[model samples]
Target: MAVVNIRRDVEDQFYRYRMPLLQTKIEGRGNGIKTVVPNMSDIARALSRPPTYPTKFFGFELGAQTQVDDKNDRYIVNGAHQADALRKLLDDFITKFVLCGSCKNPETDLKIMKDGMIIRDCKACGKRSDVDMRHKLTTFITKNPPPKKAKGSKGAGKAAGQSVEADGEGVASDEEDDDEMAKQIAKEAKDTPIAKTGKDADENVEWSVDTSEAAVRERAAQALSGSMQASLVLTPGDDEEEGEDENSPYSIFNQWLLANRPGGDEGRDDLASAEIYKKAQELGIEKKYKAVQVLLQALLTENAPAEVPKYGAVIAKMTTSEKHQKAALGAIERLAGITYPSLVPNGVPKILMALYQLDVLEEEVVQTWGKHVSKKYVDKETSKKVRKAAAPFLTWLEEADDDDEEEDLDDL
Candidate 1:
């Protein structure tokens, strides 16, 4: 029954949001050993999610199979795991799926956008941060969506909405009616005791007609029930009825570029490379590569020469053909001359090596290009510096060919 902060890192005892400490029980033995989350429902209820969600998350993180039995309220994971480990993993799940990226608040809801993207809409900040599409759980959430709640149901709409007390009121009213009926029956019994003997002697005594207590109680109960019935009734249902237009990957890529234009002014042609790379991820896995040209340009201008390998990995994946490879190398060469600080003395060499390892740049093209000096970015001095940085890598590339030939001969 002890409580801890939902975000345990806050370390504040007075924090409003809390849940019971995770309770896990180990079961079975040897190969059949498993972990049962005894209080998963309680924890999930506190987190406003189905017990299956956290249970499934545990399976995913721990590389185990999970079973969610709602009927029996039993959630089991296939291997023994410590309570502390699962609790830590739960925090990561909260970060990825529960909390809003922009506001870092847990008061958010998962919504599948028209484009099949999961977005977290923050109630506190009113920002819709797109969930990274690459996570494995995205597939699960998309398939098994939460059930839609009825509109008029208690706790139906806003997280902070009040619940109707009709059930409680009805019970209270029924109890009062029963109590009143009991008192009336006792009073009538006391007042009209021994009527048989009285009837024989009552010829001279006047008698008044009155309904029995049982009849009065039935009439009063019926009237009270009729008054409690509601005059108007409303049913709630899911309202996400409309579908959204499906834009092509290219169009989406363009839209992403337009929305994240470097400066506030649309006229400005330049943009920050890091920002572009970050936003391009939202275009999903398909169209991310198309942004490589702009991404490379931005990185060349904005990122330090030594940072080429960092962004190079991203842009390298976009290269699908010999032409794209040449273009990427050409972009690097062109950016080499720009007045902006040239890559560190060996930045180009590092970029080439990474791309080559990723199979994005061909050995033949790199060898040919390294042999020739090109000035396209800024001026002679900067271009010279760029080539000098690439010299060591170029020497290695040439020597690598001889080594490859020697290996082939030895194999022969």
Candidate 2:
């Protein structure tokens, strides 16, 4: 079993990370031709994905149905596929799912967020990159979520806490009584007169809770009856603040966009961006340039930079400070160079230049970013490629600085 770099572009035989070459077998007659990926399980193990994912990707690419036989480790595609073609498709899978979008490293884990967005957590660079939501695989990953960890695992406590929080306020299956109480409370609130003045008046008004002897007896009787149980009243503000406290504005906006998205894939990026802008305005955070940072994070994925400018107008309106600008640029670095290198197009230098001209990023920061290379996200060669992409911007910044220095000397 000869091994090769997960990224075949790196032909280095000594590349540390390696996977076995794809092996395929063609079987059956003309009408029933099918391709079996004999070593797909082994390949998937190397790539750290469920074998079915790649098998399904094969089916998707070849326009054929696929059968994943996990029990026997047999994955079959309806049409006969060449080993080379499958290998190429496997590379596509690596780019989209396996490899870290930032560093281009294959060491990553898939995390499905609560809002149904899939993120890749890169082990090497310690950066979490979002997967593009527009892909067909996102729907599959959401429905057929990754298996839950063993109860005693490190995340067990967090999962349990989340479960408890979800249980708060809204009991999923409460019968007639809870509904009746809610209606009674609504009726009382509607009937209650508004106070003309505050301070001395009804500053703190309690909702619905009966403290009478008869009410107590009724509750006791219900408990005793075994047919009914006491329903707990949650604090009014508790559940309302849960969404805000637990999630960032960007996260909420992202979920909202996903839910209320328009029909058809045409101009989806534009529509999503417009919706985000609308949300920002509604929340009164539109003027906060930092809002654009959140928007940038939610909208842009390693493989999808086309939507980067969707919020460009909103970003331009903000009076961003140097610190905020640096943070925004850092987000781009994480997305383009570190988390998703291959997916980031060559226009990154142009994007940086545009931002620099707009005063969104300073020359010093841009130069520093270009010169600093981290192999954690990529191999030396790929790191060099990232640096090369930043070269033009770095050169322009250097020349500008030199010209300024010369002008100062002439003034003296």
Candidate 3:
């Protein structure tokens, strides 16, 4: 199919579309009076190519295609994507023709050239001004032939880069007027014969409309997919306390991170932000440190039954040798309320074996009289309270007590 531009007189369709300056000046030789004219070369160069400026011109894709007649002698200028040709045609027409028709006005206007035509003013009627619609500046382009085109141009008769055939037909070679790409397809379809009612021609072309719709849908989905653009590497102590939506990528990514822990397979060594985030979340919830303390209290600290594992090693890093006694005292205070008294059934033997190593220090209350030792210094009630606190753990005392109890029957 052939490509055609808007008919003469419509340059604004494409060319002359640049941002107009408050006062733009046009170069001139100043034959008599000075006036401005547009840069024809600049307009020509801009129109001859596709994507000359924006992706589109006047809302029409410069390189879009349209359907046209395929007759060898007859020329049909398709309405779609013809702005480039339309614009050039108008520019040429306007440039060559000038002067107002209403009054046979002189060429005072820079756009028009006057040849001293008779003034069509109503001199008898108080010189009332009148117009000549036939030879007006704007309409003159329509009456005259379009500007001559250079040889080798694609669609010469129509506009820039356009070529006309021997039959006076124009061909739009999209390379010259890329917009004709679709137009060419239209011509092929028109020239091809139609099949029987149910038969189809070129299934690919038939699916084109659907494919184009799918493309648009995909683009929209991608645009609306992700969270707001933010730093992917989330910082600790981030303001997560703010009311967060369940669908937040941060939360989703955090869950994903927990599913995959740290130090996984070597192939997974390169974790993304989503994975690392999940791992960090899991660590917060595991509370591994507090868990170990609870089990240790059940064994050595609270005298509960089941033998807990060697906590000394698990907590070795937390409390060193110099601080072991102090740490043990602290552990006792923390475990006092946490009761898991079923250790006897699960594992108390190993616990007692390890506990045999602790010192049985007791609280002592004594009163001394200036460097003199006294029998009344230790009281019975204070002695009773100290022994009661450690009564369950003082298993070694039984053997010592046996010696005293041997004569208890006679004493009682």
RMSD of each: 38.1, 25.7, 41.4
Q: lDDT value for candidate 2? A: 0.56
Off by over 4 Å in 1: 152-412
Q: Which of the numbered candidates is closest to the native, going by highest TM-score? A: 1
Which residues of candidate 3, in runs, are more than 4 Å off? 1-305, 310-312, 315-319, 333-336, 341-353, 357-389, 395-412
Give the deviation of candidate 3 from the true structure as CA RMSD.
41.4
Candidate 3 achieves a global lDDT of 0.28
Worst 10 residues of 2 by lDDT: 227-236
TM-scores of the candidates are: 0.39, 0.38, 0.17
The backbone clash count of each candidate, in order, is 7, 8, 25
TM-score of model number 3: 0.17
| Better candidate number, 1 or 2, judged by TM-score | 1
Local accuracy by lDDT, each model = 0.56, 0.56, 0.28
